[model samples]
Target: MIRKTLALLLLGLFAAPLWAADCSTTIEGNDAMQFNQKTIQVPKACKQFTVTLTHTGKLPKASMGHNWVLGTAADEPGIIADGMKAGADQNYVKPGDTRVITHSKLVGSGESDTVTVPVAKLKAGENYAYFCTFPGHAALMKGTLTLAP
Candidate 1:
């Protein structure tokens, strides 16, 4: 009975993780003004999704700061436009912007930040996009996101 119980415990432990969905992802930014990934998918089973952005460059925030911003594809332009106006102090994101679903704080070399997105805010067929809000960074550093059914 003892051996059977131990075996069952181990099996439960191993199987528990397999039954859960992956609800988080990591994205890396470099001094080259680029992101390691160009797309993300949020599992519908997840109540919330997390995104972690890591700056792998050697520059300071003033020069090559990076941030992750999420919004509808149609809102990308307006978000980027106003984010530039909002400046670095605001993580380059407009304050209290309802159009934004979620965003990570600005990060510099060797720094990192995370943002949580509520899955309820996402729809299956809507077009979503993420990008860096540092001035012209969005022109090159951007990606698409989708809610996976």
Candidate 2:
């Protein structure tokens, strides 16, 4: 009985990490004004999902700031436009924007931030997009996100 219990405990320990890994992800943005990934998959089983944005460059925020913004694909253009009007002090995201689902704070080279999004806010068949709201960066720094089965 003692040996059996020890084996079961080791098995549980090994499986713990896989369970935890399902609800979180990391995305990297660089000085080139680009995000390394173009797509993200959110599992339906997750109650909440976290996105960690890492700026791996050496430039200052004024010249090369990056942020992670999430919204429906149809809302992206308007959000980006309005965010530009909102300006840098607001992290380029319009204050009290209802269209935004989740977003990370503006970050510059060597900086990082994370945003948590509730899975319930997502629809399985709808198209969602994520982008950096820093001025002209959204043109190249955008990607698709989807809820997965």
Candidate 3:
């Protein structure tokens, strides 16, 4: 029994780091209007999560700006439509849009921005969408984020 207990404790010590909470991630957007990651998992243990958006291409905000926008999958279409109308001055996100869970500021080549997502706002089994609200970029610069079980 003593040997078994010690072995179990040793295994746990080695394995703990594997499950260590990851509460943040970095995503890259390029001149081609693309995001490097297609999926993000928010560990349940995290009360909040941070996402950093980095623009890796050489381009100006007027032409190739990228911003990270988050909303429920169902809210994505309306959000994008309104963001288009809101224009570049608004970071491609509509003002006072409650549907948006969180968003990063518009970023140009070599620039970066970060946004914090409240984990409490996430619901299990609900589909969350993240995308760049730049005009005509949603089709390519989009991904899903989910709360881990």
Candidate 4:
């Protein structure tokens, strides 16, 4: 009985992390203006999803800043345009932009930021996108995000 109990405890310990590992993700951005992930799927069981952005490059924010921005796919072009006009002071995101679902703060090398996306804002079968709004970075730093059924 003791041996069985020990096996169960060990199994539980190893399984804990996997069981607790839903609804959040970490994505890395490098100096080459690329994101490590191309897609993210939010589980329908979650009330909110979190995305953490890490800048793995060695540059400063002024030269290679990165931020994660989320919005509907339809809003991407307009958002990127407005963000470019908004510039660095606003983290490249327009102020009071209703199209934005959520976004993280700008991060430089060795820095990180997190954003929480309310799952209620997402709908099944709807197209969603996440991208970096740092000037021309969006061209190479964009990805698709979806609500998983």
Provide the RMSD of all predictions against the true structure, rounded to 1 decimal. Answer: 1.4, 1.4, 2.9, 2.2
The residue pairs in collision within model 1 are none
Predictions in order: lDDT? 0.96, 0.95, 0.96, 0.94
Each candidate structure's TM-score, on Cα atoms with residue i matched to residue i, is 0.93, 0.93, 0.89, 0.88
Q: How far is candidate 1 from the true structure (C-alpha RMSD, Å)?
A: 1.4
Clash list (residue pairs), candidate 4: none
Model 4 Cα displacement at 3 (Å)?
A: 10
Residue 69: error of model 2 in Å? Answer: 0.2
Quality of model 4 by C-alpha lDDT: 0.94
For candidate 3, the clash count comes to 0
**lDDT string, candidate 2, 36-86, tens digits:** 999999989899999999999999889999999999999999999999999
Candidate 1 regions exceeding 4 Å error are 1-6
Q: How accurate is candidate 1 locally (lDDT)?
A: 0.96
Compare candidates 3 and 4 on lDDT and give the better one.
3
lDDT for predicted candidate 2 compared with the true structure: 0.95
The residue-by-residue lDDT of candidate 3 on 101-125, one tens digit each, is 9999999989999899999999999
Sorting all predicted structures by lDDT, with the top scorer first, yields: 3, 1, 2, 4
Worst 10 residues of 1 by lDDT: 80-89
For model 3, the stretches where C-alpha displacement exceeds 4 angstroms are 1-17
The ten-residue window of minimal lDDT in model 3 covers 16-25
